[model samples]
Target: MRPQRRKTMGSMKKASVLLLLFLSLLLIASEEMVAVEGRTCESASSRFKGTCVRSSNCASVCQGEGFPDGRCEGLRRRCMCRKPC
Candidate 1:
């Protein structure tokens, strides 16, 4: 937006520069989001018998399976183990 540069450049050049700057900003934002993301997954425990009713119970069994914590989910509410990737 310098006065001398503004007088020399046409409207199309200004619009192109603005569009390039906006795209660069979007690229930066997307990279930041991807870097902050974490991994999470669930798996049924073979040792955990029957239907899972409580998170506490699922957590205990998940710990036994070497996972840090777990929860009960799905329509049947099976024990789903979780761990960091």
Candidate 2:
């Protein structure tokens, strides 16, 4: 009986640890999504170049325009010029 109880407790502990790990992963994923949505750039020049901007002329085009925001950030991440928000 004692051995059986010990086994059950060990199994329960493993399950609890797995559950915590899963929850942590989920939280990290959600945080990444939020960062993606919140990130923004004013112009192509302000962009992170290869990291965000693709067009060589993007900076020239966006220079005079207002800074990009919200969905624009996502577009820039894809290496595309987006309208300012």
Candidate 3:
């Protein structure tokens, strides 16, 4: 029983160490994924319903309008669709 307990403890320790190492590597890799700089073109959503209240909502409608990205902007709060050049 003592030998079996020691083996289980050792296995748990190894698993813990491996998991920590994996998480550390994942954190480092995720940090390397920041957005790249580029030129973007914008246009108002011609088919959007009502006013653009949220940028995310505007983006969703813009995607259906066949653009890559979108945002609510300016004094009128229009949905400005965006695409990279």
Candidate 4:
């Protein structure tokens, strides 16, 4: 009976560890998806142009056109057009 109890405890521990790992992976995946979404929104050619453009204020010259915003204030700034929601 003692050995059986030990086996059960070990299995439980393994299950707990697996659950933690799964949760961690899920979190990481979610974060990555958010980042991708942000990048897509911030892209100049995004279908949604106003939303990304509103979040940042910078001046930029894109394809010979100039845009002024806070993002333009930063060095190495690039122009991105966002669509408003």
**Local distance difference test scores for all models:** 0.87, 0.53, 0.90, 0.47
C-alpha-based local distance difference test score of model 3: 0.90
Cα TM-score of candidate 4 = 0.37
Q: How much does candidate 1 score in TM-score?
A: 0.55
Where's the lowest-lDDT run of ten residues in candidate 2? 64-73
Model 1: per-residue Cα lDDT at residue 14 = 85
- What would the per-residue lDDT of candidate 3 be over residues 1-85, giving only the tens digit for each residue? 3789889999999999999999999998888666788999998898787888999999999999999889999988899999987
Using all chains and alpha carbons, the TM-scores for the candidates as numbered come to 0.55, 0.38, 0.56, 0.37
**Residues 3-80, model 1: lDDT tens digits:** 876666777698899999999999988784446657987778868888899999999999999999999999998999
Please report the candidate that would top lDDT against the real structure: 3
Positional deviation of 26 in candidate 3, in angstroms?
16
Candidate 1 regions off by >4 Å?
Answer: 1-37
Residue clash pairs of candidate 1: none
Tens-place lDDT per residue, model 2, 24-69, is 9999887844334543333333443455444444544354344332
Q: How far out, in Å, is residue 61 in model 4?
A: 27
Listing every candidate in turn, what is its Cα RMSD in Å to the true structure after a full C-alpha superposition? 7.2, 10.3, 6.2, 10.6
Worst 10 residues of 3 by lDDT: 28-37
Deviating ranges (above 4 Å) for candidate 4: 32-85
Better of 1 and 3 by lDDT: 3
**Candidates arranged by lDDT, highest first:** 3, 1, 2, 4
Cα distance off (Å), candidate 1, residue 7: 55
Query: 63-83 in candidate 4: lDDT tens per residue?
Result: 223223223212433445432
